[model samples]
Target: MPRAYEEIADERQHGRDTHVRRPRARVVRDSGRHQWEKDRARRPPAVRAATGATERDTGLLPDDLVFSARYRTIEAPGELAEAFGVCEGTALLERSYRTRYAAETAPFSLVTSYLPHALAAANPDLLDVSREPWPGGTHHQLSTVGIEIDRVEERVSARPPTPQETRELELPAGTAVILVRKTSYDTRGRIVDVSDVVLPGDRTELFFTTRLERW
Candidate 1:
């Protein structure tokens, strides 16, 4: 059966809105670095375009920002305890960072990281938030204590942002957020660190590539 005219119009408007404003085009690829490579000269890929007359600015996050991180000790939550194979009340270092953009009202992604206190206690600097954006990111931090991250697994999910997330992210109504739970393991097959990251869906893209063994 032919679609109703009103429903067709609504669908068309939604398509146009995404194409013209929020393209979600950034290819969020992993370069195998715990931190992004400093490539200030790289321009973000272009947004989906219409004719030259209709092309508009891309919805990209700011390139400059104020960085802040808070660190504290807490008992491991049950799920984390199970994943780390530690006692239910094992102490863990909880670190959270809050970023304020130079040009935008909304903040960027939210991330919370957890590490076993026993492991990090070996390096006093790991407990200090002041040392962050810490020279080489997580993998480097772990190295200072003889822990080498051998592999990482990330699980991605999405759902509408919570009321608090909407306000903090300054998201427009009906927008969603992407959630990534990343687990890092050392050569011993022990889960060494875990991070939960929340990304705003309006401006982010997820990408991955795989190589195959020679047949």
Candidate 2:
């Protein structure tokens, strides 16, 4: 469900008050092989750009390649534990993905994705890093195990890059990093995926479109 519609608002004017209905964003059901293919084709642009050096960047990410991909079972950390609503030390899968331009010394971005170990373990291919950048991304990976992502929420923040980040991104002086935490939910409103993305702020932009209801 969209958080935007979770709370209703009252419109008051000319000493009169009225309630405005806030309908949640609509979701269409996906079916059959084509939908699956379409969804797989929807892999993050970043991944698409990373796959081939000849491909032009779609403005979302740089033309790069997956620097490395690996996974391990871990006791969910504080943030992951809370985000997944699991016990403090519940087991989960941590999939780390780093990208860099083949012709550049600095990294393009850092992405760390997480999923419930038990849920993901249902599909062995998901645990193999060699299968990355998995076609359709996490969505396809989840679908292989019957998970259908219904929505995603992103929270962005900024701060000075950590020494490690500065070194990894090879950022210049006075450059800060933007952190985007993305949470994905399934059809049952379960938090199926969570990821943290770090980007060199100098080359990133965020745009949001607010849809207004026609009363």
Go through the candidates in order and give the clash count of each. 0, 0
In candidate 1 the C-alpha lDDT for residue 40 amounts to 12
Q: How many backbone clashes does candidate 2 have?
A: 0
For candidate 2, lDDT tens digit of each residue in 1-215? 12432232212224333343333222121123223433544567665434331122212233333366779899997978999999889889999876553434455567788999999989998888888766556766788899888877788899999999999877778989888898888899999889898877765545455557999
Give the clashing pairs for model 1.
none
Cα deviation at 174, candidate 2, in Å, is 0.9
Worst 10 residues of 1 by lDDT: 48-57
For each candidate in the order shown, give its overall lDDT on alpha carbons.
0.67, 0.66
